[model samples]
Target: MTKTPPREALTLAAAMNARRLSKVFVADQLGVTPAAVSQWASGHRPVPPEKAVKLADVVGTEPHLISARYAELQTNESGNVVPIRQAADGADERRNDLVIARLENDVDSLRYALGALVTVMTVHRPAEGAAVAKAIRKHVPVKFVKQGYVAELLGVLDKAGHE
Candidate 1:
């Protein structure tokens, strides 16, 4: 019996298939080594926020999706913003803060987009709304959902549904 040879692993193959992005291209764009990109793609290393932003830009995706840290940088129990990484120096720290603020703004925009989707689904197709919302909830971070906006929107949806 002839044994089949093991398939060779292609670096960043999924990204290449989905977005036509190669590890070399991403490494060049991010000023990092292909090995670093491979580490991130393999989930062996966490992507930093700044690099996550650049990676998302290169791959045409959201930073939160790339960086676990950014995804967890949501409001706290006291409604205070969670702390992000602090730079060692002054200017870098300020810049990092600005990036964090921008990320928060992006999260707000995502929430608005989700709210619109939920509104449309609930009003146009009640049955599918719950399913769509469930799928979205599964993907979104728990802290983001616990922000109270989703619940408030659902209350409005319920009122509309009853009428």
Candidate 2:
């Protein structure tokens, strides 16, 4: 298994106290639960590098470097928040894209299967039963991941056409 990153023993509470701030105020500023702030202050949980870096400015302490993951949030002496080392972000986006592509493929397969079924019924059935087949075809339901419920009548499924 991969090793976990090192955690800094941050004097978060002291820093907050020096800045004349309360735990709730610091917790609100960090967008974390008060318990998390308490944990960080009491050394129960190590300070996250991102939070450590962010709190450096707020608590007047040096930004503790933890790992490459926090490099994206690197702030310069000019104090500009630069978005760098986006490889991890890119990987996540690629994974999401793959999932969406697979879902679209599944939808396409479902539509094709329904079309074949409609075609077989429409072709094999006699002229007298054409209206019944047409009705059944119109009533055939297939689910989609997005765009909600829909029915493909006469072998046609269009998102814009329905909604």
Off by over 4 Å in 1: 1-89, 132-147
TM-scores vs. true structure, each candidate: 0.40, 0.35
lDDT (10s digit) by residue, model 2, range 1-163 = 9543334334455566778877787678778888877777666676676576565565665554322233333543355433333334465455446557768999889977866755554555435234644455556543422233233433232222232
- Cα deviation at 130, candidate 1, in Å, is 3.7
RMSD of each candidate relative to the true structure = 14.2, 13.2
TM-score of candidate 2 against the unseen true structure:
0.35
Name every residue pair that clashes in candidate 2.
none
Candidate 1 lDDT at 115 equals 83
